[model samples]
Target: MSILFTRLRHTLLPRRNTVARPSDRIQVALLLLLLLLSLAAAAGAILLGAGIHVVESARSVEQTASRYATTAVLLADGPSPGTVGRSGTAGEPGPARATWVTRNGRRHTGDVDAPAGTVAGNEVPVWLDATGAPAERPLTPLAAAVDATAIAAGGWAAVGFLLWLAYRCAVFVLDRFRLARWK
Candidate 1:
């Protein structure tokens, strides 16, 4: 890494004896500027990803606190006819209507995605909020971490790509200028 840094430093600020043209100086400056901005962009992407993960984790915590789980009895077989076309992979669940009673002893009905192979009269676990309304399940800590990492990596990759493209264009222009000068 130190060797790489030394090389980069030399490229960006070559020895005075090696400097021959104004265009070389400009190219070095542009390269250094682009490298600095790319580093800033990568840092920004990490911060952005952390923010998203925190918000998502807080939401998940809140949902977990407010939601309760219970067994819901399916009302129809094969996840209802409407969901037949929307079925996911071989083992994924499809949408269905189910009924469940909350802690207060009041019965409620709602649409839920039941596991594949579940049939009418099968009891499936469901999540409900304090108001007896269906609620989204919370994400596990591992899942949140994975999601944040993936988002950060993708964002960083995009920034790197843009910086690389700009660097390429700058080098192309500089090469053309050098050729013209030689001519």
Candidate 2:
């Protein structure tokens, strides 16, 4: 065992007069910088994605508010007969429009398209907002999970970069020390 240990140490240990090369330090530095930049890029991408999600959610909320104010109703009834040939056009009301029965028994026509497979008398939520928009909802769990993955990847990259930097620095310092001792 002692002989094996001695042989292993001898083969692994550095010899005298071996100096730390400038190229080696440069390589380490470059690797560290690359890792750090990659981490930063990942973090930035996550932030950008989150920002876009927030904007979309806000737009949905605004639409929902508009729908609520406009007293819109989901056409519980199937599409009207005349709506068969109707093409959905912007600002053009279709014949298949659902009527919103207000509390006063007054009915108002809404511009929302009926859901697919909806039969006559299927109750759907009515939006009363003026803009006919739906409210924004929070990000889905899947989206949040993706963001979390990005964050974790960035963290791992940062840790790896730091460890690499420490290792390279230690190697350089030890080499210098050994060179000095030999002198």
Candidate 3:
């Protein structure tokens, strides 16, 4: 089959006569495969990252639509200093009993984040979901883009490393085969 291919190739394009060994053919095939894998890895990483960014951006928009920011009046003193809250950080704000008025003029009382050792009647900023419950702020567009870019770069680097390892292994094996044949 290789002889036929060589004859066809020589006839199609005139070039200096040179025999292509089976090992050389195999090596050339592997090189082409490696190039294809590298390209695929790059494209896949970029596509996945773009998908993540789109999903995150849409989620941010949905959350922003149903969430709002408001101020709440503390009904009781916050946790004493040096006490960690849910976030496990003593310096971070702790949940405290607080009351706030909603846009519909309805009164609500719930737990809200306030600085440690906060006195009663102090006002603190908070975000409320559609149900008027304390909630987290929505993700911003800039944050989504940053997350996507980081994912894309990390994924590409990881795949590129693997591809490099494969290339190294292939070279080692092919070189050994060539050396053994020569010997």
- Which prediction has more favorable lDDT, 1 or 2? 1
Return the top candidate by TM-score. 1
How high is the lDDT of residue 131 in model 3? 84
Q: Model 1: per-residue lDDT, tens digit, 1-183?
A: 999999877777788888547788888888889889989988998998898899878876777788888889999764433343453445567767889899999999878778877898999988888999877776766777778888988998998899889989988999998998889
lDDT of 3 by residue, 25-118 (tens): 6666676788789899899999989999999899889988989999999999988778877778776788789999887888999899888888
Candidate 2 on 1-183: residue-level lDDT in tens? 999998655444434555535544454555566657766766675676666556655655555444442334454554544444355533332333566665445666645555444555555554443433332333454555566566556665665667667767776876786678769
lDDT of each: 0.82, 0.54, 0.85
Once fitted onto the true fold, the runs of candidate 3 whose alpha carbons sit more than 4 angstroms away are 1-32, 172-183
TM-score of each: 0.79, 0.38, 0.72
Query: Candidate 2, after superposition: displacement of residue 155 in Å?
Result: 15
Instruction: For candidate 3, report its TM-score.
Output: 0.72
* Clash list (residue pairs), candidate 3: none
Of the candidates shown, which would achieve the greatest lDDT relative to the real structure?
3
**In model 2, where do residues sit more than 4 Å from their true spots?**
1-26, 42-95, 102-106, 131-183
